[model samples]
Target: RTSIPINSVDQAIGAIRTKIIFGGLVISVLAAVLGLFVSRRIARPIGQIRTWAESIARGQFQYRPSITASEEIEALSVSLSRMAEELRERIDTVIRQRNEIEAVLSSMVEGVVALDMEERLISMNQAACRMLGIRMSDMQGRSIQELVRSTMLHQFVNDTLSSRKPTEMDIPLSSDGEVIVNCHGTLLRDAGGRQIGAVVVFNDVTRLRRLENIRREFVANVSHELKTPITAIKGFVETLRDGAVKNPKDADRFLTIIDKHVARLEAIVEDLLRLSRIEQGAEQGEIERIDSRISEILRTAVQVCHVRADAKQIGIEISCPEETRAWVDPPLLEQAMVNLLDNAINYSEEGKKVRIRVTQEEGGMVISVHDQGCGIEKKHLSRLFERFYRVDKARSRQLGGTGLGLAIAKHIVQAHAGRLTVESIPGRGSIFSIHLPTNPPRNGSASHGDPLQPS
Candidate 1:
């Protein structure tokens, strides 16, 4: 209703517009500031939680999130901390179990190989590496066939994987030398019984096979030896019963021959028994050991064989220090020495010299019986100590030899932690020596003892 000038009215309108715009700008600024503070408060805790989660994913379970803004965030941090601790414990347990499995595999004497589902080698123990002639580094992640080059092994693994069943075979490897290994392959399965891989185990059976062969041969030899004497005795007895008993001279001769054969049979049986006893004693660890003068043992052996040497017209020579000492079983050592002396005397020609010598050698004492006789051939030396093994079977029987004396002597010496060896040249001479330890071990492991000076 009040009439104003146009300039004044326009100025008033501009002022009111300016004031409204200023008020709006101020309100917008206040809203922006409050929004920034609220957003920052929420984002800061979330950022910390995210960082903590990332750390956990990276296996940093030792780190903890610190959140103080909200109860929900604090509860989440606590839950996360507990989860990390449980995970760490479970991981440590897994690592410990893996280490224990590794230790058990390493200590095994038999070879063990583990392969992954991809047929790659995952683990191999020391014995496995040694048996296969490969290094651990070279075998890892490599195919089993590439490492072992054996058709049998490859087939075994494939069969086990395909059937999820165990398989076994004897594999012969001749890389470094001939080796027979008994291999067993089995499937490795997960907790759900799903086949994951294959495990192959190997055991060396070469020595066991050889021992079995020896046992068979020994049984055959014993049967033959026993049968021969029985057959001869039966044949001679039947001949006497048929007619020879009627003539006195023939009867007397037959009786003499039968008596000689009977005596020989008795000797053989006795010697076999003695050898068996000695071997049993050694195996049972029941050898009687004593410290005795070496000279005394040699003297006793010589005296026992003096009559035989005189009968054969052989001269006996002794060469040894007077007071040399050794650890030995007195009776067994005397028996061993006597057997050697008897062998030397029986094998020597008439008037040949048989020498009994004792000397201190490297870490031991050597007692040798030397004979100037028809010596042993090299081919016969390897089995010279075997029971009933004779270089000249007829000659040995003619000389009243049982063929078990050397075998018995060897066992006796071995029981005393000694070795028996022979050196000979055909038609020249033979020397049978017993190498005894100077100081025998109180336990059962003595082979060579401390060195001793000749007294």
Candidate 2:
């Protein structure tokens, strides 16, 4: 703070100012360089974290970054990584649950369909697609009406959306055919207990309904058949007791008529029992099988039916090689053959020729009986094997036929794991064929071979 000459003092102040300014400039330049280096060091890790966050945003949660910055930065990266891992695990769990649900729905036999609030198809299983005769790819997002075209199904969907309780009905579909499906409808709900959509389950009950109808018809037919003979016998017996007994000739004739009815009743009962036994054997796999010469079995069956054939003056001509053999239940097969021959004899006119032909086919052996008889109409052929089903009821009864011979034969062939089919042209002739597999299951083990051709 010493003052010299005025000019020198001013000069000294100016030199001090210049030096202070130079020193301040040097310090600022050095500080700026150091700050830049520090900023680069910090920004390197921050930029890497930013890149990692971007990848995570793009759904790359499994991606990792090598971040070796300050402890605070490292802790932050670790927390972010943990959060990403949790998010990834949650997403994987959701995907897995969705797949599991899809699998369960696909394997179900009953048809299942899911609809959104707007009645558009959200999901449909394979069975549902098959039942509805629609493709899943074509049906998705389509309205129920557009897919099904059934009034009852649409009503059911509306009911399902409005009501929480499940409802069921039989819906008839005319897509492929007259298919009857039993449908069960219920509302689908979300986790928050809100109504989200509806689900309908379909079960094909057409075969069950047909079987029920057949059972009812069978019961009715059996009752009618039994009542006819019973009523006839009762009426003849009452007539004999009233006045016919006073005359030996009338009494004898009434007794003979009663005897015929009794015999008819016995035949019906016996045939029914035989049918029941054959059905049980077929169901329980109790039909014992053995290798036997088909010609020998055929010959035996011919002998059993020769008496009836002789009465009708029908000549049965057999055409089977002696060496041809098959795995068959000999006694059962022989009985089946005898029944077929007897039926042919009963239906054939006097002096008619019946041909029994046996040949090895692509699938297996075939034993067919060609009869020059009154061929059945196409309508009656389908139910020819049904018990008590007769093509000509009056003629069948007049010929002392039990109306169960063909049914018994069919059951016998079925027990052998075979199919019995008939081909006939009206006013021409009839051919009844028994299609048997050559390599049938032996000793409780199935043996693969050519399958039966379509009939």
Which one wins on lDDT?
A: 2
Tell me the TM-score of model 2: 0.88
What lDDT does candidate 2 reach at residue 161?
89
Candidate 2's error at 215, in angstroms?
Answer: 1.5
Q: Which ten residues in a row have the lowest lDDT in candidate 1?
A: 444-453
Q: What TM-score would each prediction reach against the true structure? A: 0.81, 0.88
Encode model 1's per-residue lDDT on 214-330: one tens digit a residue.
678778877877787778888878989999889889888878878877887888889888998999988888876766778877888888998988987888888988778787878
Clashes of 2: 0
lDDT of 1: 0.85
For candidate 2, the per-residue lDDT at 216 reads 95
Each candidate's lDDT (Cα)? 0.85, 0.89
